[model samples]
Target: MLLWNPDMNWIRNPFPPAVLALILAGCSVAPVYERPQADVPAAFKEAKGDAAAAGNADWKPAEPADGIARGPWWHVFGDATLDGLEERAMAANQDLQAAAARLAQSRALQQDARAGLFPRVDAGVGPTRQRPSPASQGRPDDGPSQASTLWRAQLSVSYEADLFGRVASSVNAAEADAERSEALFESVRLALQGDVAQAYFLVRELDAVQALYRRTVALREQALKLAQRRFEEGDIAELDVARARAELATARSESLGTARARASAEHALAILLGAAPADFTLAEMPLVRSAPPVPALLPSALLERRPDIAAAERAMAAANARIGMARAAFFPRLDITAGLGTEASQFDNLARWSSRTFLFGPLVGTMLTLPIFDGGRRDAALDLARARYEEDVAAYRQTVLTAFREVEDNLANLRILAQQAAAQDEAVAASLRASQLSQTQYREGSVSYLEVIDADRNVLQQQRAAMQMDGERARSTVALIRALGGGWQAPEPVASASPRR
Candidate 1:
């Protein structure tokens, strides 16, 4: 009872045009998303007396991050060598490159998800051969074989209407995934830069230690020469000369140990710079005596500043989007399909308009699927999505808490190290003065060589301690900067008020 109507437009275009328009504003089954709250303090607990506030605006809990490009934070130290190392790390670090590649993958996936919002079209040309049975031909038992090649050319199209927001939810999830990947890439870059600066400082600190040992070795040699000359003059015993020689040997041994440590530190720094140890050499440079002051930002701003926290928050959003995607499976899904083509027994007739064929829409064609039963599959999937969202929520909160802890830990380190460095400086000065007094007393024969030796040992130990404390202070300052999202400037000195009349 089917009749061909050349003028029937509905038979050619089965998909309702209104569905396409509605898809843009499709109803999504996903739950409304909100950033889970965390316990963020107004000021860092460890930003006590030594730290100054960054004077940033008050808290923004769930505002999307502006970005992670905080500028070249390592420049605060004013070291050209460190600045160069950081530049090389950003350009060639393997981990950073890997993170970039992962980000690209996430963006590509987002593109794939966006594709679901539109229809698919395919074109093809092929040949078909078939023989019909006697019953199919409505003929006697000995029907003739109707085997023949049918040349066909076709253009087929299919589209899934976003009736219940399945496609929309998928698109939202993909967008969130891409954002999270970008944030993770930034996190890796910040960590890499921090590593380079910290490693460079550690190497320089060892250089200072080596220099201290060298000075001690030279001083011991000088003392040994003086003890030998005094022994020849019959002013000091052979025992005194032996003691001086022992001191010289001990200093040389310590010097070699320090040299070994420096070599290891240098090798490690070379790897961080993405170079072979044999090809890298650092001309010795002592750690700077003073650490630059780094001001602290308030805890509220720290949330916005750290890339890891931003990434965690985005993960929560992606999980929330997926929950909606799972819920959409419970609703009806619409698929629209259509095909237009030409077929003829002979290849020469396939191009003729009379041989045109077309198919569209329902009756095992365009389908609207309603899941009447699937045992517990849909229920399990919905539950799984919800659980994932909760897990990401916990992860996001933990990241925030960890960031706060890191900031406080580094702040405390810098403050305490500053005080320790000052005290160590005074000890070095006092020890040097005591050594000089002991030497004068021994040359005048007012004291034995034992007192002179003991005094010299104290001077060497105190000076080395001072050098170590200096390195610790500098390294702690770098750590604080990293915890504060890899960069912060010292507060400008308050300008003096204009002279009152």
Candidate 2:
């Protein structure tokens, strides 16, 4: 019969001690994480001007129902082709796929870190045959040693006590890292969407310019024919015909260049959609000159809206947690290992109660692993963590600054470009009128053909410039949407019930 000592019972069961240690170690040493302060302005600098102010007053704050769908901001442009391309890019873009994979990896690492908080249990069974040396046993070597067979089955459990919050800190760091990765993934997705939209706009713009040049080429040919007829009739000099031919050739060259630009833009769009250039083609669609109005959000909203800022903030939190982990390294660590097993001389007798010899107990140990003599490894690690924290803080600030700058830049582009487009429209109208008057005068023999050629060239250039400006406005609108975080919002946290006492 085995006599049980009540006092030793606790020693044989180390789980109670481990639980108490874990409860004590629940106190975290990591600093409380607070988002670093950014210098934000009350209003966008460009949004304060008279033109912007008047425009803002005329444009009501766009409600979700009145404006583009928040989930797909590209819908605001009301372009079906753009919507289709964005969908395809999201489905097949390699960069987005890689970012998603990284996010998954970070989540897996978080799970691995979290596992440290729980006990690890393992079991094994094996049969072993061993021979002891007679010399080691202090016996005279006379014959071959006899082999003995031992069959054993064992189960073991081990758990770190987390005496200094190392496990908790590690888990926190991993969670922060995972959050950072998630933010980065969102950032990449938003960037891809923006790229597809911008590229699509650019291709359409090129198509419009190409059409304009084609028309200019026809007009120049007509003017050349008129010059030739006038010269043949001896009503104009051969210099006029030569000049007309030169203008026609120039127009044709421009038309060819425009076609090349359109092809290049289409190729770029195809790549954005993860397709080969040769396999992809876009129909000639007219440029959408009207940009959807964007609601002006306050500067503070940028902090919550920007994904890069969120990532930087999470990185800082992770770095701070690592510092706590490094500091915990200076303290004592507790590990508890317990095992239960049965050993027998033969496999047949291993399961017999009489033949079984059992051993079960805990081996509780505490290790004070202070790096006292290391070549400043601990100090260097701690310093590195702190430095990384500082770097993240600076990066967070910089991201916020950049976010603000992008919004301001796009806002200024839209505002000033609107005024420029108006002026350009007037220039185009005036040039058209001048070209018509010059042509009539040259036909009436009241002016030279050179004047008519100059007027026609101005009209073509002005019209092309106007079309290019429209494209710019559309592209800027997309940029502003991207700068505003592509309408992505942080998910609301679910509230958990209070724990029962």
Candidate 3:
């Protein structure tokens, strides 16, 4: 029933005339991004007494070249030990390496999605053999044989043309996801830096405690000597000598405990830095005298600086693209295919111009898919995408709120710890004065040896407390920096800002 009419135009290039027009109209279906409103309170729940009032807007914004360093924020600590640890971790830490690999995978997937927006082509050439089936009848009774050999070559081209913009929308979604993964990797790196610094401070604190114990033990030995002399002279009971011995024994035990704690901290630091424990050793670092002041940055700045917030925002964009892609699926799709080739019954004539053959067609095949008969699958997908977008929006807001709360928490801690350290210093001084007075009175037979023993014990305990607070305040300061995304050195200081491809 099919007839070929030579005068009828059976082949036409669809892309040059019709498809290009459609593609220009349907380049992308994805909606442009508008940031969702954050539902957070005006101020953080834990923010107190001028903490929320302090912001970068109140301080001087840096010059274009004066912002925080983009890489290696830990350098601000000015400690060589910390710098070396971060370097080792970046090269060898397993968690960081895994995050980097995931980022690469996402980039590759984005490229794959981008490839779908373009035409595809293939070429091939080979010897071909054809055989007519015995049951198939044509001019077979006089035909050559069961099989015939020929030379063949062909080039085929196919293109989807993306007349509905579905392909472009998908590409947008993929690109956003890739950006999110990179942000996540940066987040992991920042968190690891904070952990290493905390562990390092803990080790040094133990060293200080052990040193304190050694001095206390020496004082105890002198007290024991005085107590024994008094017992021999029948001036005091043997109980005082026994008490002195017990105090010395307790000091020795405390020293042992401090050493054990320091060793454990060292091992933990080694694992974090991705090095063997045997190869990593830090000479005792003195406790820092004071914690750093909390850097001033506004609530809006927190959203820009934190990597988790960046990742969450990107996830929202990807979800929005899915909605456009799903909506576009309801429309029709058009594709075009073409082929050119050379064929010959004889090998010598295969490449000759006379043997060339070509075929092209403007195939207007349209897919008309309706959701009327589905088991609600299309609706479910749309619903899921919307729900995910809502969730991501909520998560983004929560991340911002948490960042503000953490900054305030550390600020209060730093404030109170400073006062505690000052008060403990006074306590230690007073204890020293009491011990000196008691020693003089005992030598003059004005008071019992018990007063001297009590005074020395009080002094030792107060000094230990002061040393521990110094380390705690230092650790808290590091936490504040991490919470504020490492000293506000803006790599990209605005939300939704992205690098051009």
Candidate 4:
């Protein structure tokens, strides 16, 4: 038998009236969210200065050709060994793999969170065999204790009515987080590329320096021989010969240190590529080539293009949604529950209509929170979210500023280093001429053997200095490219094709 109270009104919906009530009640407290905005700068500090020097022209539109212009940036050095190392680094880099895994996990969790917006269904079946007690049991025990098997099967379904759109908001928030994770993965990937490239360049530079040191050692040995001959012939003092011997020995000692430094650089590169040092070798350093110009980037476009900045912005969005979710807690939640089942004392009869039973109902739960002073936890949460939003904003701005600084620093370094390199090359040329002239003068007995030795030493130092400057220019260019986010673009939509993977 079923009963309805006289005072209650009948609701014709398949969903119970309580469900509708829950949804209606929630309509009052659902949080309305608006995105917070801080002013975006029109130009980056460094770019402004650069533009001022270049006649303040409008930022050039990025060309598709520009993407293909820089051929792997590192390849400019024309080293096949470096290309192989980079390939290995990308394949086995531990941190990059971790970041990729994290992104995948986030995507899975996003899907899971989104599922809460839909209904849940479950099923169960059980059979029990028991004997009724004769004394304690009811009328069924009148005929003595009886053994029987009871069979039951049921299917249940329940779904939240999303009264305050809490589930929707939460799902959206999770999706944003997943996107943020993906961006973070990209950021990590860029960083890894930069590290590997820089490490490789450093190793190559060490090779160049050590090779130069070996040549210096040889030159010093020659100078020592010349000094000894001159002193034996009574053309120079013993002190001059001793000085030459000491300088030669010092150069040899310095060569030993440079060799060690070079070995360490190679070993570090090996680790970066996940290989044992003994298992790999890099090609000799070729003539160093200057890196391409640092492409100009507009400040307004940088945040959108930079993966880390985008990730930060997405983080702010997720936090904002969380605030909405918390506020939605003050409202009511509507739930619909239904169960269909059959039960029978005999296994054979479990499927019969007479054994069938079903239940369908709607539940409404209003939080009805009594704020009766609980140390302001709810208010604290709101404040925390707001604070986090502000923090993200500040971090975003700081990242932008830092990005500008890096570009500027590298740009200035490249410019200044170029000048220094030009000067060093000139010095090397001058030193070489001086050495030649001193040799001629020595042959003519017009200058001491010490003058030729000094000229040769200066030439070696100048040559090494020039090589070091070349390496600096190359490394700085790489840094600038990385700081600009490797020229990556946001995935664009394609017509008649599936969305991004």
Q: If ranked by lDDT, best first, what sequence of candidates would result? A: 1, 2, 3, 4
Give the C-alpha miss distance for residue 285 in model 1, angstroms. 0.8
Which of 1 and 2 is the better model by TM-score? 1
Which structure among the candidates has the greatest lDDT?
A: 1
Residues 372-426 of candidate 3: C-alpha lDDT, one tens digit per residue = 5467776787777778888888887887677777877887777678778889999
Residue-level lDDT tens digits of model 2 in 154-265: 7778787677788989999999998888778778877999999889988888888888888888888887888788889999899999999999899899888888988999
TM-score of each: 0.89, 0.88, 0.84, 0.81
- The sequence of per-residue lDDT tens digits that candidate 1 reaches over residues 1-501 is 123477887666544777556554568888999999999898887887555533322211232232634567777778998988888877777887888889888889999999998899999988888878887888987967677787888878889888878888899999999888887887887788888887888888889888888888888889899889999999989999999999999999988988898899888878877888898898899887866667777688888778888889889999999999999999888887777788777888878888887767543633767888999999999999999999999999999999899888888887887788788889889998999999999989999999999999998889888878877777777777777776543322311210100
Which is the better candidate, 1 or 3, if ranked by lDDT? Answer: 1
RMSD of 2: 5.2
Off by over 4 Å in 1: 1-4, 7-25, 53-68, 131-144, 362-366, 488-501
> Model 4 over residues 113-181: C-alpha lDDT tens digits?
889978999999889888868766765546577688889887889887777777877887898798788
- Ten-residue segment with the worst summed lDDT in candidate 1? 492-501
Whole-model lDDT for model 4 versus the true structure? 0.69
List clash counts for every candidate, in order: 0, 0, 1, 0
lDDT of 2 at 277: 95
Superposition TM-score, candidate 2 onto the true structure: 0.88
TM-score computed on alpha carbons, candidate 1: 0.89
Question: Whose TM-score is greatest here?
Answer: 1
In terms of lDDT, which candidate is stronger, 3 or 4? 3
